[model samples]
Target: MILLGYGFIQKIGSRDFFFKVIIYFALFSAVNHVYLVVNWAIDNPININRLRLYAGKGDVIELFGFIFIFCRKKLQINFRRKSYVKIAFVLLTISFLLYFSRTQAVAAIVIISSIYGYTKLNKKAIIVISSFVVLAGGFFWYLNKMEIPRSAEGLEGFLYKIKNAPKEMFSTDINVNNRAELWDKWRSYEAKLAIEQVLNDRSSTLVFGKGIGALVDLKDDFMLNGKLERKIPTIHNGYAFVFFKSGILGLSLYFFVVIILYLKAYSLKSANAISIATNNLLSGFGLYLMFTTLVVAGLYNTNSTVPLILGFILGVEHLNNLSVNEDSDNRN
Candidate 1:
């Protein structure tokens, strides 16, 4: 979609003040996080999908960085004119804030990468990148620490799928890809089964679900004494979790809104302010869609991050479309 919408991203990104798009999105997405975390900490239960957006600790802080960028733009600053090294230093400081928050390694990487791009010198960029080399190694080590033997089993299951190639392509038995293929299948299946249980057991009138940490229901009992059944929760899938919480009708409404928003943002092509601003959002969404099965996204309940990021991109694209359209009208 990003490629399809390249014209749009470039158009908005082209503007002197286009960086505001990033600023607005970062702040908005962060504030959204506050909403989610509060609900989870207080409410017995909440929709995992909804929480996925802003509940993340990093989600909040990262937005602050964007706010910083926005402030700079408002002041009419230029990287080429200012102290690029100092700018990189500030961003690096912000990254530590994220590292301590829910381990947002990827977001930090992207942010630092962005900082490098905005910097003035190749030599300085190389220095920044090299300094992070240690960081890259540390992140991998962290992943190793987080990935236990059981998680390794997840990896093996993925590998088996690749080697055996499920009787059907995405059906099952996806190997080595670990969470990508199998986790996706697992989450998707789990969500469906759990929902079926809900429908059969409960009436149409939706009420609060099994309650806090109900994710670990063992054959319908919280105490593990009942039976050694699998204790899974949150459906491990974004849309599914929402449906489980809000019901099918809720999901239908959401789908309608999302589809409308996506279409409106996607229609522009290198055209104007709106399209330019929204273009990057569309690209990220496209990238996520291509490689991400339900699993990669739903993991850690990171649903909101995708949409928040996508939404920002869309907003920028929309703004760019307007810019271009006006430019054309002015010429006309």
Candidate 2:
């Protein structure tokens, strides 16, 4: 991880190189999912669930970060061409909401609002406030009027099958509405059991943890029956996973990395749009990781895209520091 961070920092002086890479990668992923959806439509019309460009709901949000950055950086900023941003936002928002996943939809709303607020701070704030009230009111009214469906018999078994299955297991998209239901089970049982075992353990086990992948020892009946039956169950919560596997020292190190990156981003002096956008993306992603670690895996082992993007953002901050140091030396 240290080596990788160093490598990314080395590339910070290059403007828009990493940002363009990220945007192009997301575009490729989006296109790939479109093809997947088409294939699924032909093969299994009845079970056309939302298409994921990548695994996990959090990944969907990351994709939105790419899209948000792309639209902002790629589109022309003039009034005549500003329509492009609006058009892109509308189309991307609608398509992702309907076919991608709810998480992406929510991310789209957030990033769009944020970027817009950056451009038209005072006006955007008022508009966003009014829009929020209107949307909230309408949503509540719809919920009040809608009829609730009763759970059918044997549904639990079906859910169990999906929940324990390797690909579908713990996937929020597979059973979006039942997330709380699944989380309750993980929290009340599996996690609880693991915590108790730790508390009862002797030695300095709490300082070093049971070692990586040790949490898989908490498997139960649901996991046993699944095709992706595990030798060790994944702790859905990243923070807990780190603490359980690596102990307090590990968790502290993890936070130390985040705090250092945040400080770099906060202190960066770049005025370029791409640099500014990278900072915004980092800030958004940092918050996303904080919340997501409670429900899904963190950037550690899940995927490379997140760490890669974050690395480049940090690299930009490094570039800023370099410029600052150079200016001071020249003055001296």
Candidate 3:
């Protein structure tokens, strides 16, 4: 479906195709998160715990980051430059608060700040560093000070858990006290454990993998509680899924493609303002997806959003090349 969607979008051949998809995704994701936030705020009929929005958390955050870049780079709705930046900044901040997605938020922040810093480096780096410092300070303050409704008490209850996430990462405990665990136990820690389990006896599997359904077979061995008879059909971590399914060779190829794309996107040089901005945003999106894949299980998941993202990047890159070549020909 993702591939088909990508093909269809590319077939459309509209320069604004990527922009339209990203903007729509961003808007829908933002609205969904806002709805959850309001429910969390009001303790309403639909609470945060019970609410599960259709969009993946990874997609939501990536969309938010993509939209932020769009706002800064492509938006020309009669808004001043400052107004565009402010709008993007506000949307990002709101999404972080309401969605409570740490990995995505971290990725978005790092990418945005890096782009800002890179763009300002020749002029002055202090402005970029200071901007980041202020944003971080304000965000932490909000996280600590935000009042939680009684119905959504888990939000406040996890403050200490979040604070201890780094230290608790190595711990073996998967119980309540260990709630601060990164990737929610299954994706991060258990995924590592599963890898160890697979490689313990059959080290050769590292080369060729156990063959396609191998991860599914090993799930019960590593994840079963003895209380449950069912197995998790999918591995939570995308890298782990690939490694278990196709071994180290597959994983290497995957990263190889990603590295090529990142290099290609960043290496694009353009004096045209729109071209530069689009290139920067595309590069940032690439960065954001790199982190998202760790926890997203997107490699083999049928519902992966990464393909669509790659499609847009490739499309935009193609368009950029055409424009650059046209300029060169005209100059000649």
**Best model per lDDT:** 3
Question: For each predicted model, how many residue pairs clash, with residues at least 3 apart or on different chains?
Answer: 35, 2, 0
- Tens-digit lDDT track of model 1 for 1-332: 32333445555565334344444455555455555566664964443323343354355335434433533543233556356525543553444343233224434443334322322235765787677778766755555555333323334433333332222223423342454454435544455555655565566524443343445232432223255446665554445555555566655665665445434434544453334233423432342332232434322354444444443345445555566768888999
lDDT preference between candidates 1 and 3, better one: 3
The parts of candidate 3 lying over 4 Å away from their true place are 1-6, 36-62, 74-96, 114-155, 167-184, 216-230, 269-271, 298-302
Error of 1 at 8 (Å): 22
For candidate 2, give the lDDT of residue 148. Answer: 35
TM-score quality measure for candidate 1: 0.40
Ranking by lDDT: 3, 2, 1
Q: How well is each residue in 1-332 modelled by candidate 3, as lDDT tens digits?
A: 44664566567765565655565566567666766566555754443334333222445434544555445444222334666546655674566555555665576665665444353334465676677779877866666576543334345534543443333333455553443343245455556655775587477888877677653543343324344533455665677777777788988887886566445435744456556655665566556656656656544556756566656656665666677789989999
Off by over 4 Å in 1: 1-57, 60-82, 85-193, 198-236, 246-249, 252-266, 270-274, 286-315
TM-scores for every predicted model: 0.40, 0.64, 0.70
lDDT of each: 0.44, 0.51, 0.57
lDDT of 2 by residue, 158-200 (tens): 2332333333223333332465455435533444455555666
- Quality of model 1 by C-alpha lDDT: 0.44
When sorted by TM-score, best at the front, the candidate numbers are 3, 2, 1
Best by TM-score: 3
